[model samples]
Target: MIEKINLNNILFLDIETVPEYKNYRGLDLETQQLWEQKTQYQRKDEVSAEDFYERAGIWAEFGKIITISVGYFINKADIRNFRVTSFWGEEKKILQDFTNLLNTHFNGAQHILCGHNAKEFDIPFIARRMIINEIALPDKLNLFGKKPWEVPHLDTLELWKFGDYKHFTSLKLLTKVLGIPSPKDDIDGSEVAHVYYVENDIDRIITYCEKDVIAVAQIFLKLRREDLLIEDEIIHV
Candidate 1:
């Protein structure tokens, strides 16, 4: 099935998210209590809610997407180029711009959205954030009544699992094993919140997010037994 899908039909993507507030104290009393209750199990007895707040971005109710980088293949004159772009800044605007991209270009039945572990994280995060922002779901992201096989999504991590449901692999690890360029040269998911809140470096984060998109695309190419994208073939727009 993977071999049947055209590379041009896949929109490779990655997202960076941070907590809704910079600090746990930033939340009102009611929300603070809610956060405590929400993460009770995850935090357990190891850490306080304030200490655990940094991970809140993993949950849609407590976080917002800062950047969503998407890449697609374009073949002209038998030359293939992978173009990557990012939607960022205010959460709502970021989501709206991403939704516009899907609704406009990749909404066709042949188009698909792909990422590493995105079926579990990026896709659902974007959808929940869109709903929170009151933005209508684009056909590509809307799974309201779609059957399992009807969903136009691909997950590199799931593909790598090969029916071993208990198996899990990070994009960085997968890239290393598969010999693709690593996307974690600078910062990683654990540091994104600090970079956004303390370092005030969104540009760096955007670069990181775009690299992840490129890595995801490259990984997909590897899985298809195709040649990896050359540096010259990757364009930022």
Candidate 2:
């Protein structure tokens, strides 16, 4: 049986993104259409690169990452500490600050970065933006260079795939299945861009990110209890 991973070594993270430029909505629409077409023809079951690009563009323009929320459960402690750091002014500075904080706080540690759909979206998106800004990625973020199973990463979506892979298993859905309460009553993934752009409310974005972090932490707790359990009855009796 797999041993229960110590939650203290894991960092649950979530980011809020915005578009890079104004008037990019039309471009995003066209890209989405092309992505759908390509996916319908090529992968058939996967989202196309164009779709990814469109979402990225929306995030770059309308989705400005106003906040990055991080959560970690302290070992042998009942309290869980979290921080929601805001990135307001320049995108480059924001990314640099986030990266610097990661390096300063979590460098050289054997950390398992956890998030929802992080393997397919969050991690790649953050890495690409960091590269664009010429920021050096921390050692733990270098998952592309590592072997698939060897990567120190945990995506809750992948864990959910053990039972169902075809359906849309959002964080909300997974939390429900695991008997974890949903903390997303304020905002959601769809309204994130709108809040960042139309409302210009960075706090809303940060709140959404905080909810996501909690969801991730809850998912980690469930995974540890269910997938990493060792029954003494089977071994001793």
Best by lDDT: 1
TM-score of 2: 0.73
Give the per-residue Cα lDDT of candidate 1 at 97: 95
Off by over 4 Å in 2: 1-3, 25-64, 77-89, 163-167, 226-237
Deviation from native of the Cα of residue 156 in model 1, angstroms: 0.2
- The best candidate in terms of TM-score: 1
For each candidate, give its TM-score against the true structure.
0.98, 0.73
- Across residues 115-193, which tens digit of lDDT does each residue of candidate 2 receive? 8888777777777777777778877777666777777778888887885768558888787778777767787776766
Clashing pairs in 1: none
Question: What tens-digit string does per-residue lDDT give for candidate 1 at 155-182?
Answer: 9999999999999999999999999999
